[model samples]
Target: MGRMIVSVQKSILVGEVSAPASKSYTHRAVFAAALGDGKCCLSNCLISEDTRSTMKACRLFGGSFEEISDKIYVSGFGKRLKVPDEIVDVGNSGTTLRFMTALSALCGSEITLLGDASLQKRPNTPLLETLQKMGARAYSKNNNGCAPLVVEGKIKPGIYSIDGSVSSQFISALLLVCPLLDGPTELSIHGELKSKPYVDITMDVAKAAGIEILEQIEQTDPTDPTDPTDQNKNSVSAKTGGKISYKIKGNQAYHLENYTVPGDFSSVSYVLAAAAMISGSDVDVKNLFPSAQGDLAIIHILKEMGADISWDKKEGTVHVSNSGKTLTGICVDAGEIPDLVPTLAVLGTFSEGRMEIKNAGHVRFKETDRLHAMATELSKMGAEIIETADGLIISGKGGAGLFGANLCGWDDHRIVMALFVAGLMTGGTTIDTAESVRISYPRFFEDMKKIGANAIEK
Candidate 1:
C-alpha cells in the first residue's frame, strides 16, 4: 500500500494474525544450505528484501533452487562457490551484503559485493578489516567503508579477534565460513557483542549443519549489547589461539526436509501496542513463539507497564487486553532490544508519565539512526520526546491523541512499522510511506489489516 493512512477511534481491533518469518534464521539457513554439498530445502522462508537478497546470492554462487509454494529447495555442492562472472547486487539488505562479502572471500575468485542506494551508505569497514586479518584480501572498491566491496579470494584461516564494536554481521559472516577453514578459528571479540541472540542463531544453525563451534569468552567488554539474551557461549582457552573449531564431516550437505519458521515477535509489537493505547481495547495475536525472538521479551515489559497479557506457549500465541486500565509510564533499559525500542517509545507516548530508555546508544547505526528518527517523528506527532546521547526520554499522554502528521519512513523497516502503529493511535489519520517495511516484513501492512486495523493507501 502506498501513502497508507491509519485512522481508528478508541476501539478493539479483532481477528487473526500470522506473523512474518524470522529474518535472522532465514538468512542463516540459506547461507548454511548453500555451503552444503547436498540438497537443502527451506520452508516458510520469508520472501522479503533481505531473504530475497540471500536467494539471489545463492543463485549467483551457482546454487540451484526450486520453489515449492513458499518453500525453497537449494541443491548445493559443498565445494567453493563458483564465483559469479558479474557484480553481485545486494539491495538494501545489510545481512546479504555483509555475509555474502565474506562468503565471496572463500570462493577463490574476485567477487564484488554491491547493494542498493541505502545500503551503499552503511559501513562495511570492520568486515573488510577482519577478512584481511583472516588473510582474505578485502577492501571496498572506492576505499570507503560502504558497499561495492571488492574481495580478492584466499582466506587461509588463522586466529583473529574481531573488534565487536561494529555490527555482528561481520562476526556471523566469518563464523558461517569457519567450518571450511584449514584450521580452527578462534575469535577474540574485543568489545561487547550486539544482537547476541542473532549470533547464537548463527552458531546454532552452523551446528545444525554438522558444523560445531567451540566459542569461549575470554573477556566480555563492559558495554551493553543490543539484546541481553540468555543464549551464552562457552569460553575456551587462549591455547591454540583460543581457536573455535567446527566439525564438518565430509562437508555433508544439510537438508531441512520440513522447516517451519517461528513467528516473528518484532512484527507482533504493533498489534500489542495498538491494543494497549486504545481504551477498553483487547487484541488476540496468534502463532507467536515465546521461545523465539529476543524482542518477544517486550510482552513482559508491557505487562510490567500494566497491560493484561496472556500467553500460551503450547498454542504459540498471546492475548493482550486493557479494560480501561491506564498505561503507567516506566523507565526501561532498551539496550538489549533496540529493534523494539521504536515500538516501545510509541507505546510510551500513550502512557501518563515520562519513560526513560537507557543503554541504547547503538540504535544510531541500524537501518536508520533510530534514536534521532524516533524523536523527530514523535515530535511531529505532538509527543514530547527528548533525544539523548545514549537513548531517549519520552513524556507520553500524546496531547489528546496525535494530529494528522506526515511521517518519513526513512526506508527503515522498524521506523516504518512504528510510525504506522502510531497512526493507529492518532485520533486522525496519519500518513506514511510503506516501501521500507519490505526490508524485513513485506507483508506487515497486509497483516495489520488482518488484525482489523483501519489502514488504507491514500
Candidate 2:
C-alpha cells in the first residue's frame, strides 16, 4: 500500500456526520457470530482493515462471511474449527491476533498466526502462558511472547490466570474461547486490569450470543505465576490491589443471529475534539449510542476541559459547539481510556493549563507507544509535552506560541488522527503515515472534509 502525506490548514468545522461502527464491537461481534451455530446477520458493522482481518481469520476457521446491503452475514463454524490451510495473517489488528491465538487452541491441528510489524511488536506472552497452563501447546515462534505464534488444538478446561496490565486483549481473548471448552473453567485476572471496559465489551457481546460468564472481585497473591513479567511479580496492582475471577461453564454454544454494532466513540473522538477546539465550529456526531465502550468517557473529559459538548443518549448524537470559552486543561485518569490519550493530548496542547495523564503505562504497548508518539509529534508542532514513564504531561499553551510543522504519524491510526486534530488548530501542519487511518476510519479525512476541515492528501 502506498503511503500518503496530509496537509491540514486551519479552518472552522460545521456539519453533522454519522460516526462509524465501533471497531471494538465489530471485532468481538464478528468472532462471536462466527463461533455461533448458524447463520448470523451483523448490521452496521465496520468494514475496515482491522475488522476485515477478523473476518478473514474467521473464514480460515471454516466460517463464511459475505457482505450484502451493508450487512455481513456469517455462517459460524461452531466448536468444530478446521485447521487452517495457510498461516493466519491478522495484519495490524492486535485484537484479531490475540483472540485468534486463543481460539487456535480449539482447532483439530496446529495453526500458526502472525501479523504485520506493529502487531508483532505487541506483547502476547500473557495469553500464550495462560493457554499453556490450559493444556494447549501454544508459543511464539521466537519464544519471546510476540506473534508468529503457533497453537495446537484441544485445550483442557480447568483453571487459568492472566496478567491484565499490559493489554486487555489477553483477558478478552480468554473470555471469547473459554465458554466453549469441554469442561468448566475458572479464569483469574492479576494486576490493575487496565482497560477493564474492553473486557466488559467482550462480556456484553458474549452475553448477547447466549454465553454467560460469572464474574467477581477476589484477592490473590500478586507474585503468582500469572504475572506476565518477572519485573512486576512482587508489586500489586496499585489501582485495585485485588484480582478479578471469572467462572464459565463449558459445552455452551454461541447462539447469535442478528446483531447491530453501536457507533464508535473512539473514532468519533477526533471529530468531536476538532469541533470543540476550533472556534465558530458546530458539529454533530451521530450513531453514538450508549454501550460498554469506555471511550464514551470522551464526552465527560471534553466537558471537564470546558468544551461545550453534550450528548443526547436517546438520539445517539453528540453536539459540539464553540461557546467562545477557552478550554482549560485538567487531570485525567487514563487507566480505562488509553485510546483517547492521543486526542486528549492534542486537546491539552491547545488548552490553558497543565494536563496530567496518569496511570497509562500500558499505552506504551499499543500499535505504537502512544504516549511517546504523541509527545514527540506534538513537540514538533511547537507544543511543550513531557513524556513520563506512564503518561504525558503537557503544559498547555492554549494555542499560544503554537506553530505548524511536519509531524510523523508513527504508522498508528489514533496517533495520526489525533495529530490531524492538532493540525487543524495549527495550520501548515503536514503528517506522514496518513494512510494508517484505514485501519479504523477509512473515511476519516473524507468526513473531516465534509465538516469543512482542510485536510488534503498528496
Candidate 3:
C-alpha cells in the first residue's frame, strides 16, 4: 500500500463503536494458555501484528493454536517446551520480545530471539541480567541489552533483584517464568516503578491460571543496612524509599480453562477523545471494563479537562459528547496512563488552559520515544508543547484550534491513531506511514469513518 493521507469533511462526529480486545490482556492470556495444562479456549483475543508475534513465540515452545469461530483453542506445552528450530522473530512487539526472552530459559537447548528494527532498539538488558542471575545464560549478541538475544536454557530459580524504573515488562516477564521453575523464585524491585498497572494485569492473568504470587512492599531504612525482613521493622514506603517484593512457589502448574479478554481501553481512548474534541459529536464506546484497565483513566482525565463524558458500568459503555462546550485543560499524572499520552496530547492542543503531563518518562522506550515524537509532531501542526525530562507541558490555545499539516507516524501504532484523531479535527492533515495502525487497531480508520469521520485514505 502507498502512503495514506487522512482528512475530514464533517466537523461533527456521532456514532456507536465497539472497542477492540485488550492487546495486553490477550498476550498474557495466550502465554498462560500456552504454558497451561490441557486445551485452553480464549475468547475475544486480539488478532494483530503484535499479538501474532506472541502466538509465534508460544508455538516455538511447543504450543499450538486453533481458531474455532471467535474463540482460540491453545494446546499448551504443559511446562515442557522444545527449543525452536529457527530464530523466534517478534516483529515490532516489545511485549512479545520481553516475555519470550524469559520464557525461553525454560528450555534446555539454546534459542535465539530476533525482532524488527523498532523492536530491536528496545532495551532488554534488565531482563537479561535477571535471567542470568537465575542460572540462565542469556545475553544480547551486540551487548547493547536489546534484541537478537541468545538464551541457553537452564534456569535455576532463586532470589533476583532488578531496578523497576526502566520497564514493568521485566518484572512481568520474570513473574511468568518463576512459577514454572524447579525451585521457589523471589523478585525484589528497586527504584520507583512506572507502569505499575501493567503488573496488575500480569497478576490477574497469573491468578486466573492458578498461579499464586505473594506480593509486599517494604520501606528502606537508610540508617540500617541490614535486611528489613530479618529486623521485623517498618521502613520507608514505595513513594519515598521502598521496594516491592514478589514471591512465587516453584513447580506450579498452569491449569487450562476458558478465558475472555476485555475491551482495550488504550485503543478506545482515541474514539472518546475525538468525540470530546469535535463539536456536536456524541459517541458511545462499548464493551469496556474500567476497573481492570489503567488506561481507563482517560475518562477521568477528560472529565478533569471539562469534557462531557459518562460511564455506564452495568452496560460496559462510555458515552462522550461535546454538545458545543469546549474542553478545559488541567494537570495530569501519566505514570499509570502512558498508553493514553498520545491521544491526551491531541486533546490538550484543542482544550482551554495549559495541560501538564508529567511522570511519563518511561514512555520514551516504547515503539518510539513517544514524548519526543508527540512534542515534535504536534508542534508541526501548530501545537504549543514543551518536552520535559519526564513529561510534557502543553499550552492549549483555548479552542482556537490547530491548522492541518503533514505528519509522520514514526512507525508507531499509537502515534498513527492519535494523529488520525487530530487530523479529523484539523481537516487537511496527511499522515505518512499510516499502516502502522495494523500493529494494534487494524480497522482504526474504518471504525472512525463509521462514526462520521471523513478520513480519506489516499
Top model number, lDDT: 2
Deviation from native of the Cα of residue 270 in model 2, angstroms: 0.5
Model 1, runs deviating above 4 Å: 1-11, 218-258, 398-401
TM value for model 2: 0.95
* Model 1 backbone overlap count: 7
lDDT of 2 at 420: 93
CA lDDT of every candidate:
0.72, 0.89, 0.84
Per-candidate TM-scores read 0.89, 0.95, 0.94
Q: Candidate 3, which segments miss by more than 4 Å at Cα? A: 1-5, 219-241
Model 2: per-residue Cα lDDT over 256-348, one tens digit each: 999999999999999999899899999999999999998998898888888999999999999999957779988787887889999989999
Positional deviation of 358 in candidate 1, in angstroms?
2.2
Cα misplacement distance, residue 383 of candidate 3 (Å): 0.9
